[model samples]
Target: MSSADQSHPSGNKPLGKRARQKIERPRAILAAALDEFMLKGFWAARVEDIAAKVGITKGTVYFYFDTKEKLFAETIRSFSPNLASESEPIDKNRPVREQLTTYLAVLYEAVAINPDAKRVFHLLISEGRHFPELLDQYFAEFLAPALDRITSLITSGIERGELKSTGLASSPEVLIGPAIVANLWGIVFADRHPRDIDAILTTSLDLFFRGLLE
Candidate 1:
């Protein structure tokens, strides 16, 4: 190949292999780290094994993440749904009950039904005490944002007089508590005893709406 051809490579293609690898390596590391963490849990998981899974050395992993704790935290952050961006669309024109049901259903799908979310939740429950800072990070980045969205929905409903002044808007944790319990049930029980999750959520939502509706 001529020097010009060599320099331009695929002509319009802007990135070279080295440059592309630099962009992709961190993602690759995070994916491998998540798998390793899920398999071995935090204390038992080894950075070298994660590196081997990515076909890189331990030093290279450290070069990117600097520490296993950092890698674990980043893995959770990486897989976490950006609730701010992925939040369910709420139509103000719709009945508040319908809007809330739709919103909670979407939240349940993301937090309970998603396999990655379950694994991350298990990590938090099992290892969070050892890493309080990471737990705080998870709350700040993931849970807090989701709860804030739910609070906004409830607050709007109350202001519009569609929902009763039941104090649910101020304590959004009450809204999500069932979801957290359901997710924990899945983690602890697995398929040993399966529950009809949808039916349960529907019944629960009906009772909740009855109390909240004006």
Candidate 2:
């Protein structure tokens, strides 16, 4: 062995190769699983297909994720970028409408702009009862925190005298109802009957501000 090669005891195996392998193997599996899950619904997706997608044998997949269910949960948790962050409180110093608009733009990109994102939500709405744990993970990762942010924004806007009480202020669902509608529309009809997402947001904002503002 050369002097550098002698420094590590793994013969011809490169240094850190094992560590890299450990990380890359699971990641490859997860990436493949995400694609499979997106293409195939959670219930219909197969581990063998995921393994094939990763170019690995079924045994290799089981070594990392004990069951297909665990693999699916891990894949959704890791690869679904929508749940990555808690919603940020709006900038109170700015106009509430402007702040809300900016926040919604970012949120819209994560939920509406990304085609794959709606599939995850569709899975949750349709199959959440079966995979309750994954549903809970989704709520914790995305929905709950985002709802909290909306509630906070509405409360702050009400306090600042910038908004009027429309009886929907207490409910985050009511406050951000348009997002849900937009996401659902995109999921169902965007391919054939494309709609202007920007226009939807703007019109929703206009109607919302009119109702909320004094």
Best-fitting candidate, measured by TM-score?
Answer: 1
Best by lDDT: 1
**lDDT score, candidate 2, position 158:** 77
Clashing pairs in 1: none
Model 1, position 37, has a per-residue lDDT of 94
TM-scores for candidates 1 onward, in order: 0.81, 0.80
Global lDDT of each candidate: 0.80, 0.73
Worst 10 residues of 2 by lDDT: 1-10
Count residue pairs with overlapping backbones in model 2.
1
What does candidate 1 score in Cα RMSD to the true structure? 5.0
* Clash pairs (backbone) in predicted model 2: 164-212
